[model samples]
Target: MFEAVIWDFGGVLTSSPFEAFARFEAERGLPADIIRRTNTVNHLENAWAKFERAEVDIETFDRLFAQESLALGAEVRGKDILPLLAGDLRPEMVEALRRIRAKFKTGCITNNLPANAIGSAGGRTLYIAEVMALFDHVIESAKIGLRKPDSKIYRMMVDALSVDPAACIYLDDLGVNLKPAREMGMTTIKVVSARQALAELEAATGLSLR
Candidate 1:
C-alpha cells in the first residue's frame, strides 16, 4: 500500500521518551505532564520547537525551557533532564526498519536536539550510529529547522525520499506529529507499542516484521 516508510527516531525507533519522563517524574515528584506542558508553552513557537529548528542554541534553550517549566510549577533544569531523553533503542524496531528498507524506501523524521546541545552522554552517540545506518533518508528537525506536525517537514521527507505523500506511511508516537502527515495524504500509524507498530507495518506493506 506504500512505497516509502517514515519513522520517528526518539519514540518509535527508540523506546518511548515518555517512559523515561515518567521515571523522572516519579523520582523527582514532579507532575505527570510537566515536560510535555513545558514543551507546549508557546505552542509551535515553544522552546522545544525553536531548539529543534536550531533557532536557539543549547544555552538559550536551557534558559528558556527552565523558564517555561518554572512558570508552570517545578524548577526543571533542562541540562539535568536532557540526558534522560535519549531512550534506549528498540532492537525489534531496528530489525523491522532493516526489513522494510529492503523493499521500501525509508526515511527518519524526528524532532531532536543536536548532539552538541544534549552532551551526547549515556550511550546516545552509539545508539544513533547504529540506527542511522539503517535509514535511506534522515530528516532531523534540528538539522533542518523544521519540526513535525508542521506540514512542511512532512513534504520535505517524502520529496527527499523521491516519493509522494500518498505513497508513504509515517509512524510516530505523538498524535500531534502524525496529524500533519495524515492531512498530507500519507498513511499514518500511531506507534504506542513496538508490537503494534510492527503489526501496522505488516498490514500496510505486507512485510512479515514479526
Candidate 2:
C-alpha cells in the first residue's frame, strides 16, 4: 500500500499556466506561439530548475530571459514573462489532496522560483499555502537546491518523509519529472486531469472518494 503521496504544485493542483501565457502574449502584440516557444526554452534553463535550485536569483533570471527573448528575435520583457506563472486552484483537486492527507502522509514537491518574487511574477502563494497546509511536508526546489526529474531531489524527499520509495506515490503534470521518481521505485501518476488523477489515486490506495 502507498503510505505517502507527493504532488507537483503547478499543473496538478491548479490550472495550467500555459493558458495564462497565451492570453498575456496576445495582449502584448506578440504571437502566442512565440511566447510559448520562449517559455519552453525558459523552462529548460531559467524558470523551474534554476530558480527552484537557487542556482539563479530573480535579477539573473530576468536578465537571462531578456537575453533569450532577444536571441529568439522577440522583444519580451520581464513584465511580459510574469503572466506565464499565473495559476488557479481547482476545488476538486484541493479536496482530493485533503482526502489523501487524511489517509496517507502527504507532501508538496514543487519546482518553484523564489518565494519573494512569486507574487510579482504571477505565482500564487496564498492558494499554494492553502493546499500545502494539508500536506505533512512541503519541498520547494529553490530552497533545496534541487529540482524535479533529478534523482537527488526525489531521494531527498524520500529521506525527509522517512518513507520507502516503493511506498510513496508521486504525482506530476510533466511526464519527464516523474521518470526519475518512478525509477527510484515510487509509484508515479501523470496528472492529466483532476478527476482521472484522483481515480488513479483511489485505485492505487483503495481509498474511495465520495
Candidate 3:
C-alpha cells in the first residue's frame, strides 16, 4: 500500500488554469494563442520551471513575459498575466483529498510563482488556506526554489514526507510531469477528472470512498 500521496495543484486540484487564462485573454482582447506560445518557450513547462527555481524572480519574470508577448505581437501586461495562476478548488476533489488524508500521509507539490506577483482575487487567501491546510506538506516551487517535471523537486517531496518514493503515490494532471515520479518508482496517477482519479485511487490503495 502507498504510505503517502503527493498531488499537483493546478489541473488535478481544480480546473486547469489555462481555462482562466483563456477567459482573461478574451476579456482583454489579446490573442488567445499568446499565452500558450509563451509557455512553450524552452518547452511548454520551462517558464514555470525557471520561476520555481528562482533563476528568475517575479519582477524580472513579469518584464520578460510582457516583452515576449509584445515580441509575439500581442499587447499584454503583467497584471493581465495574473489570472493564469488562479486556482479554483473542486468540491469533489476536496472531499476525495479529505478521504485520502485520513488513510495516507498526503502532500502537494506545485510550480507556483510568487504570491505577491499574482495578487489576490475571489477570496484567494481563504482558498489557499483551505486547500493547503489539507496537506501534510506543501512544496511550492516559488517558496522552495524547485519545480516539477524536474526530478529534484520530486525527491525533495519524498524526503520532506519522510517516505520512500516507492511508498508514495504521486498525482499530476500532466503526463510529462508524472513521468519523472513514475521513473523514481512512485505510484503515479494522471488526473483526467475528479471522479476518475478518485476511482483510480480507490483501486490502487483499496481505500473505500464515501
Candidate 4:
C-alpha cells in the first residue's frame, strides 16, 4: 500500500537526544525537561527553530538560546546543546532502513544544524555520511530553510519522490511532526522505540524488519 517510507532522522533513526538532555540537566542540577521546554515555548519562532532553519548563525543562536533558557529558569548555552544533538545511531533501525529501501523508496527529513555546527566531525559527520547514503532523497531544514510540522515540507518530499501521499508511510518521534503527514493521507508512525517502530513497520509494509 505504500510506495515510499519517509523517516525523521534524529529520534527515529538514532538514540533520542532527549536522553542526553536529561543527563545534562541532571549534571547541572537544573529542572527536568528544561531544554525541551525552551524549544517548545515559542515552538515555531524559538531559538531552536530558528537555528534548525539556519536563520541564525552559531554565535547568534548561542546568545539567543541562553536568553531563552534563562527566561525558563536555568541558562544553557546553545553550543553546549549542539553536542547533545548528535545521538548515537541505532543499528537495528539502520538495518531496517536497508531492508525497507530494497523494497520501497526511502526518504529522510531532518531538522538539523548546518554542517560543522557541532564543532566536531566525529559527532555527526562520520556516521551521518554513511547513513545518509541509504536515502533516495533527503530534506534538511538547514539546507532548505524549512522545518518539521510544516505542511509544505511534507508536500515537498512527496513531490520529490513522485509518490502519492496516501501511498506513503512516514515515521517521526514527534507527534507535532507526524500530524502533518498523517493529515496528508500518509500512514504515520510515532517512533517511541526501535522495537516498537519496527513491529509497526512490519505490519504496515508486510516485511520482516527486525
Flag regions of model 3 displaced more than 4 Å.
28-32, 43-47, 70-75
lDDT of 2 by residue, 3-24 (tens): 8999898888888877777777
C-alpha-based local distance difference test score of model 1 = 0.86
Clashes of each: 0, 2, 0, 0
The candidate with the higher TM-score, 1 or 2, is 1
Highest lDDT model number: 4
Clashes of 3: 0
Instruction: Write the residue-wise lDDT of candidate 1 on 1-210 in tens digits.
Output: 578999998889888777787789889999888997887777799777888889988888888888989899987877767877877779899999989989999999888887577666667687788789788888888888888778888888888999989999999999988999999899999999999999988999988996
Model 4 TM-score is 0.97
The digit string of per-residue lDDT tens for model 3 on 44-119 reads 3354456666677777666777776777778566556676776677888888888999989999998877757677
lDDT-based ranking: 4, 1, 3, 2
lDDT score of model 4? 0.93
Question: What's the CA error at residue 83 for candidate 2, in Å?
Answer: 3.9
Model 3 per-residue lDDT at 57: 71
